[model samples]
Target: MASSDDAPRVFQPLPGRTVDRSAAYHALLRELLSLVGAEAPADDEPRWQDRARLAVRKAVKARTVQGPVPEEWFEPMMRATVHEPDPSFVGHLVVPAVAAWGLRPVLLALLDHLDNGTPADVAGVARAWYHTGGAPEAEHEASRDLYRRYQHTALRRFVTLDDLDARRCLLPGLRLQHRSFPPDMHELVDQAVHLARTSDDDYLRHRVEIQTRLT
Candidate 1:
């Protein structure tokens, strides 16, 4: 028998206001966790993996966050980060709220998803990390290494991945915001481009242009 309380817990948005997008996102999160072999943390569990959530919220303006942020909110945001956060999700989360608050969460979130097997999404994370001001020296000692990893490990891994969408999203970060690349970086780019060409899909040919300004 289904518990009467379970229905509301599954459908209700954190903070008690009903938001269609939030509700749908919560449902999708549970499904993804099942697929990934992870389980939802109980309310009594320690949901925060680190101080990143605190740093993100503390940076927010007083007007936006009224009081102590409900803990359930972190479940969705942290889960989103672990999945190597999508560009739209990053945009919605970072640009509107956290990015303006502080770039620390941006860097922390990028750190969490370095090995998720999608080159473009990783690059997008790196791009957002840098755009929001990568690794302030006072805060993080290994900031430069993040960019190095993006070039050497994350973006370069595209050649080994078969995700067409990752390939499509690759061009934007590659073309924009790149100040330096390792000597063999072009070789990897050529290989990825070659793979895209062989597929002969127009969407595979898509190139995301650099934004002139943050939206």
Candidate 2:
């Protein structure tokens, strides 16, 4: 058998060419094995190999009208079909909350720019702000309600924070007010308050500065 490192690189179908089923299957298996070998280290080889196999199986079962499998489907298949949540799952949850707080002013500024028909470089900031911010009281009540709902929902399946400090790895470019879990929840709560204040301040500042200059 050829080593994974020597596996065929091209999977894209050539124009006006029909793919042979046997050849395509071999090519895909080689690619999958190569990806698994490249991503998995020696220490946890078996576990990663199992995950790769499961990912492939799930992808195959879920395949629809497939010629060559779209490459993007593979990673999501790996993540979604995995039996255990990766360590980054918690990190992923925390980053958005931290960003809602840490980037409140910038988001408000972006919204202000958007309202005035000015272009903003930060795409999705406005949408993130709306989803995570709004009226302070409403946002706070919404957070509390979500916490209650999650308490009752499938989120209870996950373990509680055993290592707060270890889990609170600061996401890039944003400074969270608190670094410890549980306590850092206050940082997320404070975002609504900051958004309310900054939205007002930004409105006044823009009116005095940009709008006045335009007038």
Candidate 3:
């Protein structure tokens, strides 16, 4: 989400990019495998997280000591077929990208992250949303069709319902003009503008109106 006068709209098709497991993923798996008496962590201290994973280790360790499930249960639970058999997904979510996305709490998280994120990182957050929304390339210069695609409905709801400052600061900011969408597509925008005008988390009456009016 570069703030260039012209933001590049690079949409990846199915099998877009290979997933890279971050340190965070490793930390969680290490903790889980240790809890099941499967794989002891190679290090005494956590290789990644300090407080959060340590807390989880303590809790799960406490539960395991209580023996809620028998050791016999661990073998079959490890073989659960409900899970995907993809080699890429064997231990963690290492799937390649696709145009489609599930409406997950992560979407809400991106909106929440925009306000507090550093100036350097703000565009990254916005880019994540734009890509996750599957927003296609600009259809109209005057009105960037951010919400025209059916795939973008979840994104539309998120951007519209998000706080004015975040909407103004992050994705689809003042630089971009919002298209007037169909009632079905635009319903959330109306609600958000109404909420904004009514002083709900909107300090300026025209916080949202001003953006929509952009040429």
TM-score of each: 0.47, 0.18, 0.29
Show how many residue pairs clash in every candidate, following the order shown: 0, 0, 0
Residue 161 displacement in candidate 1 (angstroms): 0.9
Q: Clash pairs of candidate 1?
A: none
* RMSD to the hidden true structure, all candidates: 14.5, 21.6, 14.7
**Native-referenced Cα lDDT, model 2:** 0.28
Residue 19 lDDT in candidate 2: 17
lDDT of 2 by residue, 1-215 (tens): 11121111111111111112333323443455454333322434665534444544444433432444444544332222121122222122122322333323323343333233211111112122223222244344434433232222211111121221111110111122333124635445244224323443333223223211221
How many residue pairs of model 2 clash at the backbone?
Answer: 0
lDDT digits (tens) for residues 108-139 of candidate 3: 34434444443322333444444433223332
Range of the 10 consecutive residues with the lowest summed lDDT in candidate 3: 91-100
Tens digit per residue, CA lDDT, model 1, 1-215: 11221100111101111112333444545543443334454435464212232333333333245555433344354444433233433333444234233444545556555456345444444433323332244434434455455555545655776654444544343422233455557676566556655675555443322211212
Q: Which structure is stronger by lDDT: 1 or 2? A: 1
Candidate 3 Cα misplacement greater than 4 A, ranges? 1-127, 130-147, 150-156, 159-179, 203-206
**Candidate number that wins on TM-score, 1 or 3:** 1
Looking at model 2, report the run of 10 residues with the lowest lDDT sum: 164-173
Between candidates 1 and 2, the one scoring higher on TM-score is: 1
Candidates' C-alpha lDDT: 0.41, 0.28, 0.36
